[model samples]
Target: MFGLPRPVKRLIVGAPVRADGQELDLDVQLLLLMTRLENGDLAARTVERARRGLERGQIYLDRRPSRPVRTRDVDAGGVPARLYTPQGLPPGSPLLVYYHGGGWVVGGIDTHDTVCRYLAVHAEVRTLSVGYRLAPEHRYPAAADDALAAYEFAVTGAEKLGADPEAVAVGGDSAGGNLAAVVGALAARRPAFALLLYPATDMTVRRRSRELFADRFYLTDRAMTWYADHYCPDRARRAEPAASPLLADLREFPPTYLVTAGFDPLRDEGEAFAARLADAGVPVAARRQADLVHGFANMWPLGGRFVEALAEAAGALRTGLYAGPRGRGTTGGGR
Candidate 1:
């Protein structure tokens, strides 16, 4: 405090001053401090420690097990995925293929296990949580490639999993949400709908929120830049639809359920993507958690509202995935 610069002082404080005058939820406020990511090098040890800190905080919330759902590990195309199915949903239920968010660098199946289980039981649909290849290792196109593969696996292996191929959707939070959007745009076989939770939709474009909520929020602009550096090191590739789906055409995007946290730096871009989808004549249902921060979906330590939010998202996924028809489709993975 005596010698630090203003920027360093702000990082130390880490309290968001919301433009809307809304206060952050108490649990979330505590979590922001407990899980505050380091601002230094994005080295393997640093990232690992950050991930462990997040998981440690998560243990308190994830301690309570999800409603008796059954989960099994399987290869979704070439990608590894954990499939969650409700206890008694019968065969041929809807399926939602999900990706976990970690800026395509950190996070995996275990980090999002509870979220997938909650969705499976609450939404009454099968949930396939994908473990896509991470970046600074696999880089751009790898995660996108896995997302498409996982969707294809869901479509083709539906009957085998006791799911209805036609009633399948693609969804995820943050970076994973970006993958879902890309799959929606480029997958050879279409999904029934999409659920994007505070997605990083446009890496190439910076929005006002990126600057406004940059530091205090869990997802900071500086951290985002670091993630982008790892995920899409090439400047030109950052503009590609695979990396920034917001730049892609959205005319044929399925009905979408988009959620954005008002305090999240990614807020504006996620909203802009929803607007674009709506303008393209795609059915859209968008919600903003006015007092929440980024990563709320997986941060169980934040308590009830976060749980309720997951339920709300699951409900939306159920509604969108099963809305139109009950007819079944042929099951065969597209190469």
Candidate 2:
């Protein structure tokens, strides 16, 4: 299926991660740890474990860099976020208000610093990677609120960051993708496109795919449940539009390009969200990534396809954002 060279194929599938709990691999161990955190009575326990995990730098997002990295911070309005600007500055280029993915719990700016630099260099754009406060510490609206706040800040302060406001967009993978989707919805009237990468569209956790693959998939049912629990502490938060963008009406979303990994547990929800968006007359382009598992975007060495993915994303941005002939806002004539 994936016509990669011999060694790369093995890398794609991973080293046969065993299902038996005793023979757990890194993800499985983390999965077990997260499960414990979710069910525990102590709130700080969960937050501390997540913080420790991030600090360890042993998670899926361990991509290394080969560029001159510049660090800075912007008020995610009130939410805190660190921004990474890559080497080889491209003046007045498009900006990506990126939200890092860790099911909204485990990831932050430092963990994702290399990946952001990769995107900025490969896509030739300025990416403001938002470190919106993690969940199980902050609830639903907090991260979503931070995503939007960062976006507005980018819009208001584009010149200072050396980005063009007219060419700005929003995007993320997993939880960040969900944030990007909701951010697009909330700022529909704003001049921006969306580059969603395997977004968690539905928070209800009722998709048949999840049920079927719960026990065995790359993204185990246990892991998904754990992620959701951490992202939404109380029952009420899970149902909110910020936490569950799929539950919200999609009529007002911006032009979007949603990417889904074929083997991911969230595949069905991403597909469903695309359907809903199209049904609501929103322009949407979804690419299904076959021959890959969940979290491939963050697995650079394993998949080695992040480079190609970055190129595709750049092309999508060109089509979605602009006043050019192929841009979304233009038609045969004006509306």
Candidate 3:
């Protein structure tokens, strides 16, 4: 199915899917169906198999070659990371330390390369895509620890990475977003900004969206539970601020731009966190992509609404990093 031509894929997608008062993007519906046909029952797959499947799926969906961004392998603190710098970008530009989403287990640098490239090119900022340790192997707090270390590295070693030390930011999608929120709250020095995409903010409780879009949305509830069990087997510990940053104090968090998909299981929690940040007097802008699903960041190459949504996020990222402080509020738009 993934091997089909773009037009052919659209033909197969047939019609948009409507559920719970919103219509899912046709491209997203097609991708979810293909994923189901390609890899059935994600929770039943072995960890290695799940990782490979996610990487393969991302590569297939995001087929656009690298843009004008120049990339280099670098060590962020002790964590391996890839640094992307857009062509002709001047030194001392802002830097975004990014983490990839895979429920803390499946994704890596290769899986999220296209996303970083898009941000580097569109947002016009230096991007360091962190390759953090995975779970069920490294387990709880390992990824979080690496996330903070990488952010510190980006701050302290910004000159070496060709970025402005004071303008360093943290951003990521899904589980990576959780890490970004954790780093935002726990970092010794606050980041200049934060970009969280459909973050898994609170792992301790399943919000309504979790139950509403539990299946057929690219990210299933069973798979989420599987991920949580592997990443943090101690159920009680899931409530820790490191594991569930939504519960953390946000008064000192940096200005943030958070985007959530209307159909994603993590949607409600991400919005809830944004509301908490605003109530804490932090500057925040939250947007809901009403016609999308989880993992839309990797689907931008599909064009149409996917690209439009991501482009909005890129614009917000640019503004957050370059426009200085902004107002705090919740805003909604999509489709």
What clash count does candidate 3 reach? 0
Model 1, which residues run further than 4 Å from truth? 1-17, 36-45, 64-66, 325-335
What tens digits encode model 3's per-residue C-alpha lDDT throughout 95-213? Answer: 99999999998899998999999888888789999999999899999999999999999999999998888889899999999999999999999999999999998988889998999
Q: Candidate 1's C-alpha lDDT?
A: 0.80
When 2 and 3 are scored with lDDT, the better candidate is 3
TM-score of candidate 2 versus the correct structure, residues matched by position? 0.78
lDDT of 1 by residue, 1-335 (tens): 22345465456656655576667755565556544444422223566665665565456656434457788999988899999877767788888899999889888898888788777776778889999998877988899998998898889999998888888888999999999999998888878889999999998888999988878677778778878888889998888988999899888888899999988899999999999998999989989988788887886434556777777897787667655555333222210
- Which ranges of candidate 3 are over 4 A from the true structure? 1-11, 65-67, 326-335
Off by over 4 Å in 2: 1-47, 54-69, 188-191, 301-303, 322-335
lDDT on C-alpha atoms for all candidate structures: 0.80, 0.69, 0.87
Q: Clash pairs of candidate 1?
A: none
Q: Kindly list the per-residue Cα lDDT of model 2 for residues 50-127, writing each as its tens digit.
A: 557545634545555566657788775776766666666555667788888887877788766766776666555678
Model 3, residue pairs in steric clash = none
lDDT of 1 at 130: 97
Best by TM-score: 3
Question: Model 1 — TM-score against the truth?
Answer: 0.87
Would you list the rank order by lDDT, best first? 3, 1, 2
Ranking by TM-score: 3, 1, 2
